[model samples]
Target chain A: MQIRDLVRRRTPLGWKQLVHSKGRMAIATAGVAFAVLLIFMQLGFMNMLFESAVMIHRQLNADIVLVSSTSRDFASPGTFPRSRLLQAVGVPGVADAEALYVTPRDWIKQSETNRGERAQMLMIGVRPDFAAFRDPEIAAQLPLLVETGTALFDRKTRGNFIPFRQAIERGERPQTELGGRTVTLVGTMQIGSSFGSEGVLIVSDQTFFEFALNRVPSAPSVGLVNVAPDHDAAGVAAAIRARFGTYDDTMVMTMEDFIEHSKGRMRRDSAISFVFTFGTIIGMIVGVVIVLEILSADVHDHLAEYATFKAMGFSNRALLGVVFEQSLILSVAGFVPGLLVSLGLYAVVRSALTMPIAMTVERLVLVFGLAVTMCALSGALAMRRVRKADPADVF
Target chain B: MELSRLSHWYGAGETRRQVLFELDLVIPRGEVVFLMGPSGCGKTTILTLVGGLRSVQQGSVRVAGRELAGANEARLIANRRQCGFIFQAHNLHRSLTARENVRMGLEAQGRGLPPDADERSERMLAVVGLADHANKFQHQLSGGQRQRVAIARALVAEPPLILADEPTAALDRQTGHDVVALLRRVARERGMTVLMVTHDNRVLDFADRLLEMEDGRIVAARPGAAAAAPVNP
Candidate 1:
């Protein structure tokens, strides 16, 4: 048989029924697309939230970290004595240790009316010689931080920092006040902002002590440690924790454990879990309902035709194939437009919210698979009417 | 085909009203028989039984050598593949064109597609005088043309038997007569047996034999008046 005829023979009549109604098909496709958009957006936001929560930890330049035993998370990590870092360096398998200070400083920006708006800015402080940040852009600018009264600014920080960014890009210094201290923005980097901190600044430990209002000089927020080449990082972290457990007031952990601790804390404190997980379920339910209504109506409209086929010896399986074909067509047709629209939406949300909304291949495949399952389940449920079509009754 | 003491009912226990009363009938192969009856006379019930569309409640119904009295859906589907059924409503799928509807009949046979299935479907459409309208959907066709498409669908697979329930009920007198004449020519040309139920008296002349039904039993059987006359080729 010719390929055309062979294909036509296998194609069920439901496909024709779906395409024949131009208005209904468009409406059905739009409904499915809306549901898909909901799911994609929710998943994108959730992923961005998680990535942002671990942004600093992921870029940390140390294998093991020390924190205050009472520290909740990186956002509000309590300070520990700098002596703990010195003590950690004395342990075996310890290459070196550094003190890193993190605190949210008040950033003041002057608007057109000469009125200043104050925003909280997260500031990280490390020694000039042992640069702690891992980003190539920031690492390249480490020497600039060593200069007195200068700090590197995060270009991705939220709010109206575009003027300052443009000024720095033009190779001119734009000064901003941090905790009432006159600090010049010497360079810009791509470290992202987070929910807890609206913007970020990188300064030397001495500059941080100068910019931060009530920070003690002997204490640091976190302690960074590098394991010796032949030593296991986790083993050294355990050794430090064991040696410090009795007297010292520091929490010792490998970098990965620190990241997980922050992530676990965020999951417990934030509403991200409820919004994304529940949102996806709601989207699927909406899709199934819309598809069920449309497919059921299509089946009802073609009851006589289905009965005729049944009378002509079509099995229930063959007849059900028609419904399934319609559903698959709807899924594929709707998903392409939904994906295209969501790309535009992701761009809008990322720009507007300064969040890391991205379209990964894994998310794309996941949402498409979900769309198909939603439509398939609807088709299966709508087959009830097809089963009731008795050939004798139609005659 | 044969039916001996076959009966059927519609409802449960007290509400059950038997539609067919011990119907005993036999139709020979290659004969075109028309069943004439008023509404509620059980013409359709017996036709459904013979076509394996309904279960035989009592006695036996054998079509093409298979007993259908206790047959399951698979058996019924297998038996149905051997027969072509045409209905009063010209129940063509509205989404499909005239040619596609005819192709469904051949597809129902479950044998893999024959090389000429599409061409054969077109040829059958041409035979029913719908060759030019093969691509036209059901709603786009007139009443006569729709019935012609239904006829093309019924005969496309060249089954051994054809069962038609009020095949031309929706057409006018001339369309009705033309439809029956087309059916008679095709049945004779293919040597296919046909059992048709109709209330229209104008097409009675095309039947090789006629049986009159009343209240669930056959009241009269005689040679069709047209059997003695030459049927138009």
Candidate 2:
């Protein structure tokens, strides 16, 4: 009679409905959970793909990149006279600058070692002291490269290409051959930290020119700049690019833009986002349908009882509230498992690969919010029977 | 209270089939009335109308001072708390225990009575010989016992008007007689306005008044030979 008492009494009925018909409810919960897992996996893969693709840009310590107009974006090579590096340094409010070149190509004899894997490896050519803006570990490992005839390899490049089979098969050391040069393995870096050849080779400019005997005029055309710690790099980048022109293609990138550029194709092709977006849509649709049908069937199964309640003088609004609560309870029970299963599956995929598959609290919140809305809408739609069933219709 | 020109039909449009015809009838409040008729003679329809479960289409029905014809939905709902109903199926919510079902009726009126609700429910159950079965589920109890719980649920709300559609139709003759005797005693003791639709002549002795309905019309009304004067108590 009292709304509170009806609710207290009615809650057990929903629980009983869920338990009595475990077969259907279990299947329904599974359907929703499976959908959630699928979406989580898609999102994780997206993160990993972008992280690996943009490793060089992300690790580059450049605040303001000064490049020719023809270059693709920051961390990309720009062929202007070496004077541009000086021009960048002399500009008002300028502090410090470093020059390097980035290029992508198959190993000179990568096929001979059969490590010509599918990955875009970045090539950075700069001075040993210029290592400040190149590979971060370069500054730490300068002593090795200082010994002459030595080089530093980018960890990001190696992680992107080499697998456990080759790394462990060669035991305690993993080395790769590129550009007719046997670049000895110096050290390893963090995951997705490579910029070139699955192994970053750091050599002096004098040594770089010997390897590039047939290449274009290379005066370290790509400059990595360090701003006065207090100045905004993005604002400086915008100002310099507006004033600069590339005899070769050039562009400037803020650290954030560089990272977004790393996720470039994934974000742009829309197909990748489409797959994730598609998973979300399918998840919600399936959740809605399963919830609707199950609750609808529940209403039907309890028709006589509903009529009895009506006969006892319960209002239509009262019955509506019960059904609404019932649907929410079902969704909450189902969603918790759905989210857990999804996170567990994501961990498995991340452990099984060298990709950057990731999960965030925001993603869980999103899925939960969607599930609640879908369940509530489904419940409202399913209450037609409870509202319209006439006690007179029953014997 | 009275039903004038009462008749009911099934379905709509071309498929409609009339089940009851108009017949004038009267029964006073706070009295126990037994509505008897052969199976499918629309005995339940009259009870439904009086209980505020169905709208009266072709007749004027005055129940507890409200017209059954075109009654507002809100008023009709408010009418529910003033009445109690039991069905042939003993329609207690199977998911609830005996006491919870009784509490549900009282709760419907938003008056928990908490500590007292349990005690009152226990007493009502004992009155119907189900005090010990209060914790039992409807499915766990025998059919007759289930009916007793349903009766307790109906009375727990303390409604002045109580209607039953063959409350004991599922019980054996002895159990049926006991159930009716309990209904009679409860009605008289509580001063409840009670009417029950039943084909079970075996329990007719419990009725203070008998109204025989046929073809949806009340053809005769006979008061008990020793109908007691209305007791204020």
Candidate 2's docking class is acceptable
Error of 1 at B159 (Å): 1.9
Best by DockQ: 1
Across B1-233, the per-residue lDDT of candidate 1 in tens digits comes to 88898888889989999888888889888889999988999998887888888887899999888899899989999988889998998988888888888988888887645667779989999999888988889889999999889888888999999999998889999989999999989988898999999999889988889999998889999999767876444
Q: What docking grade does candidate 1 earn?
A: medium
Which residue segments of model 2 deviate by more than 4 Å? A1-12, A20-25, A50-55, A65-85, A108-120, A132-138, A142-185, A191-223, A234-253, A260-265, B110-119, B225-233
TM-score of chain B of each: 0.95, 0.90
Instruction: Indicate which candidate wins on TM-score.
Output: 1
State the C-alpha lDDT per candidate: 0.86, 0.68
lDDT of 2 by residue, A139-243 (tens): 665554444334454433433334533452254344444455554445444434332234445555544554555444345556677777677888777666665
Report the error of model 2 at residue A324, Å: 2.4
Model 2: DockQ score = 0.47
- Write one digit per residue (lDDT tens) for candidate 2, span B1-233: 77778777878999998877875777778888888988778888777777777777777887777777788876677777778888888888877789878877776663333546777888899999988888888778998888888889899878988888888779999999888878878878888888888888788777778988777667788885326644543
